[model samples]
Target chain A: MPMTIDSSEVLKRIEDAPLLSSSASRLLQITADPEHSLGEVADIVKTDAALTARVLRVVNSAAFGLISTISSIDRAISYLGERLVVGIAIDICASQLFDKPLTGYEAQRGDLWRHDLRVAIASREIARLAPQDMAVDLAFTGGILHDIGKSILSEFLTGTAQSVLETIEKGEAQDYLEAERAMLGIDHAMVGYELARKWQLPEPLQQVIRFHHKPSEADEEHRSLVYAVHLGDIIAMMGGGGTGSDTLQYHMDSAYTDYLDISVEQLTMTLLHVEEEFSKMEASLLDGKDGGT
Target chain B: MSNLILGVGDFGASNSPGDIVKTFALGSCVAVILLDPGTRSVGMVHVALPDSSINRDKAKERPGYFADTGIPMLLKQMSSMGCNVRKLTVKLAGGAQIMDPNNTFNIGKRNILAVKKLLWQHGMGPVAEDIGANYSRTVSVSTNTGEVVLSSPGRPPWKI
Candidate 1:
């Protein structure tokens, strides 16, 4: 049996929910203009104490391979650069957005968090291989939040939605999207795109949420970034880093190669690279959060 | 039944006996399987991306994840297991496109192409294979007979 989410109710809840702002506004402002001074970005970051602490902790983490310790957000921003600092802040912000439990997905409170982090790491690595025209940070952000819609649906799948969850756990036959489409009439990607648009996320990220599961549908301008996230998600899923509820729907779009100017040879190399990076990033991101939220 | 088992996130074991040398649910990644009929040995790798040169730091942490780095490592491991490079027969699988058509995510295609290129460079070519499909696959290789099989949803098991 397929799953379903009441689109109207989901949309209503999203609308009613308070717009929780993290450091995303400041980070987006910084990313919009590269020439924007670090002082300006730092000033915005200083307003949020929690964001400031997360930023400093990440900058000091071994993932960046910084030789010296970063004592403050400003120092870390200087060391990591405007683009990456902004990217990390945005990621930290979205982490809160996805902190809720996903019922249909069988994801624990933090399962989505780990999944998003893996996709971000993989997307950044894949972006390095694509043409320089692509924005690597944009790719990373898109990858991290590609499944935001799942969180929205999870909340509404209250009573009868339990069956959908059961079907997923059994690994019966249907992919999550199909189950969702059958049960809820709308898939997570669509729901995610709606939420993204409502939240005023950047176009590239919204495009990713809509097309990460279907990259061939993306426009020429955003195709490569969409493709990177698609591949990154696949790499994470294949490596056993997935949330384990939706393993049946591994779909691949062939046109992605032609769009990205990459051959089959390049794809193989890229997946290898994604796997390597996921391992490193996974260790770094989960360093002390063992107790599980 | 002494079937060779390739552990998760790992590659290559030759001259071992087992029911299968298997890699599971390869989506955008590629699995390169090498079989030696003479030695009845088999090896397989579940690689996530095509290259490691993009980020050397990540590559160093997980060598088995990239095609450029992992394929060579697989070959070296096979050789160390008493399998002759010349007698080794190769087959490839995985690299499914799991996203939409318009999104331009072709990492699976890239991994498939990368594996083929690396094989060509190393004077090794795939004798038979199934790659670049739109669905995920679980690949299994029998060490006893060097038979490679692919299983997908609603599809019959087929030999490569």
Candidate 2:
């Protein structure tokens, strides 16, 4: 066993990590309460020039195919719905964080970003087919941020990435998380959970980051949400977004399917649409910045 | 050399010696790479599923995404690029399965079997490969050297 760093050190390192845009952060805060009016939130989004520019660019982007211009943040919100607009803002912010390569995990430029986006897309799809009560935007956010820990821990693991992957490849470790723990005394899931907490995201979303790889371990109330993100992770891998050294080391937990009364066939069909959904999302919103100018 | 990438459900052929062709992370999917030294041409496809029979609608549009239609379609593309079936050397990679007992799909094995059957019909086989392990691979073929390199992080680079 290699000498491992303690959790405290990892916490201290991430203490100053980059977080969501202040406008996006306040937007999440105001929207978290059930009673807030969307116009109030849109008014806040309208104030941040950078945030407003992103929203207007996405709203008018070819993805929406709007016949008439949206004209304002409130009009854009009315057209796309409050959840997705916030999602767009959060997505733009998250995309910046995910753009870099995590070499220890062997992610090339744009690999992690693509994978996380696909996962977020898959989670939105899975949410529809799973339990009806699953929070829509939360599911998407959880999916995108599920692997944030890998990005955080990657810089620390560069020297040992080889040995860690070798152990997993050679069967000394069961999977990437196990390999990470044995070598570093911490794993991506826990680190990701901590990062989510530090970002002041809702608790349920934090649970998703922590137990996505092992949904059974999540608390009862959050089990369904965890299931959606978990299946989303697997489907993203199936869709060819599966990159990095760790690859598909994650195992599918059938118990979640059993618990949720969803069949593998049902799950598989939903999964088949993952690539299509990703393409649609990419073509519509993310890459459509080119369409405006 | 510049790189030409074939994303999922994609296929491409090139006779240009200045371009390298590549596809990333072939899990259950298979990447069939063909190189013809005589013409200095290379053709590649990233096959995402085993058989398109289940989804005939998709097969009509994306025949290169399935084994039955994809491998043949890839061969036809290579043929258009002056690659002779008898002279073309093939390289195969990807088909890693989930390292879990509950992995029921076994799409990786199905992909490999399907590719082998198609190649058998053509009287050819993979000249070199590094396949069927539980790791995602990024594979590239340089038109300059006709060398295919498969890498998975810490795993030593496998060259064909």
Residue-level lDDT of model 1, residues A5-108, one tens digit each, is 46687777667544536567656645545366779878877898766766677666766677787778788778655555555565555555567766555556
Question: Poorest 10 consecutive residues of model 2 chain A by lDDT?
Answer: A284-293
RMSD after Cα superposition, model 1: 7.1
Model 1 lDDT tens row, B111-153: 7888889989999898887887455577888877788888653
Per-model TM against the reference? 0.63, 0.86
Evaluate all candidate structures by whole-model CA lDDT and list the values in order.
0.68, 0.76
Task: Tell me the DockQ of each model, to 2 decimals.
Answer: 0.16, 0.45
| Candidate 2: regions farther than 4 A off | A1-3, A19-23, A26-49, A62-67, A78-84, A91-96, A260-272, A283-293, B54-57, B99-105, B120-127
Please give me the DockQ of candidate 2 compared with the native complex: 0.45
Q: What would the per-residue lDDT of candidate 2 be over residues A195-253, giving only the tens digit for each residue?
A: 88887877778889999999999998888888888878877776667547777876777
Docking quality of model 2: it rates as: acceptable
lDDT of 2 by residue, B1-160 (tens): 5779998878888877789898977776789888899888888888877777667888788888887888888888888777786899988998876643445446677778888888898898998887776677879888888899987666778887
Prediction RMSDs, each to the true structure: 7.1, 3.3
